[model samples]
Target: MRIRATVAAVTGALALSALAVPAAQAGEAPTYRESAAAAFAAAHGTSDKAAFSTAAAAEMDITFSNFKIAQAVKVGTTNKVSTTVTYTLTHGADVDIHSEDFATGPYIYRGAFDTPDNMLFGDYAATCTDTSATTATCKGNIDVYPADGELLNAHAGTWKGGALALDYVTGDYADQGGLGTTLVQRYSKLTVNASPEPVVKGKTITVTGKLSRANWETFKYAGYTNQPVKLQFRKKDSSTYTTLKTITSNSTGELKTTVTASVDGYFRWSFAGTTTTPAVNATGDFVDVQ
Candidate 1:
């Protein structure tokens, strides 16, 4: 299968805003519906998790239906088939199997809590499990819990001209059988995806980069909206910043900045920015030509 890295888009500033303050701030992490929503979006972006979940369910016959091991083939031998095969053989005999299944649920995620907290009980609505030759489906809420070892953190603010942070707990389990360990992955860094700064004098060009869930922490309940990222720039040769720009990032975390070049001296430019909405923590830098 062709694997593509998925980028989670924060559609609005509100999503990032949910993680503005660390849950540890008030002796607990601050969470809102918006942050939960962001976390959900981030989880959906990880293709591996989704694929693993789908693959596991099919092999386990945990879906609505089950598949019988109709045939088995050995690499060099043809008739060495057994009446019944182990779970390892059904999925991939030679391949190392992990996680019994995959699931994302429970609306509320706490950053400060060391373990799972059912702040907002989440009910699974449906499940789709597919194999190369067979398909299965499950109706109604499935009994899914946060995988073990799942780490949840909240980071708020703007990084590189866009709101960036870990909204809430989002992760993939080594197994989805509700027994495997959960792995919390970081989203992409919030970025300003603009082209290189122009070198022409008085020719101000926009600066931008891309944002990902790894870069920003978010929540699963709250929806995100566009928010401005913080940026500071100065001439490489000069001591002080030549210009400071506050630009808003799109749903994809793209920012543009206009900057004019030096007319007299040979100059290089550098920039620094953050997406610290309620607070400033996430920061980044970029280069612009003379």
Candidate 2:
């Protein structure tokens, strides 16, 4: 298997609106309901904690910084993945965080939190080590498996993450309520191969390979079909490799193409990558032209 290195930065902006009206106002019920619905949808997995009211959620301040994960995750491998995230939480001026705090932590996941179909993979918990009154460092390993059955294609590509939520005691004397924040997550992997090393100058040289991405469900690499890949060649003692042709992979992630030998040179397959998977280039195979 041929390997390539790729890096991607996942980031998103957090928006918070100030509350102008008082919580006791009866007209604010609709706004609270809408906010509650949105918050509930973004929560990772299922939680017994109640959704935070709009007023309560607005008062809760949470920010995630220095979030990082593995640059390359291999397919068909049980990778021990680690992530670090810094969090700061404050309960505005009127709310006493210590008085109402019951459960507080971060939740990380890959895929759309609201859409079940898009929520292909995830890890809900990471242990937090406190560093200050409202700040802490969170770290943990996420077990990524390969996707099987209905979710086979869902495994490969950039997995979005950085979802952090805080659970607190609410109600009259502090019961249970929580809210969530959003961040970016990305993961990608690739593979390649070549054959028929010796050939005549005028004879057609056949090249073949495969394109795959990591599957978190089964912890394996699965075929990424119908994707375009570039065939390139570098002449003997030459510094640069030029693109020869473009071809697409088949259903099994197989890639194939042909080129006539001109001189002693090297041949390779390159993938530009996708949103979920990182870019990769196969090792060159030297062909001796007679």
Q: Which candidate should be chosen as best, given TM-score against the real structure?
A: 2
lDDT of each: 0.29, 0.48
Cα deviation in Å at residue 84, candidate 1? 48
Show the lowest summed lDDT stretch of 10 residues, model 1: 158-167
Say which candidate scores most in lDDT: 2
Error of 2 at 61 (Å): 6.2
Per-residue accuracy of model 1 over 246-289 as CA lDDT, tens digit each: 65556655555665544322222222322322222223344455
* TM-scores for all predictions: 0.28, 0.54
Q: Tens-digit lDDT track for model 2 on 1-290?
A: 11111111123311111121112245433232222223443232222123444345434555555555555444443444333433444333443344423333333333443332222122333456656666656554333333222223453454444333444334211112222222222233344444466788788888887877655555566787898899999998997989999999899888888888789888888888765566788888889999
Model 1 — TM-score against the truth?
0.28
Candidate 1's clash total is 66
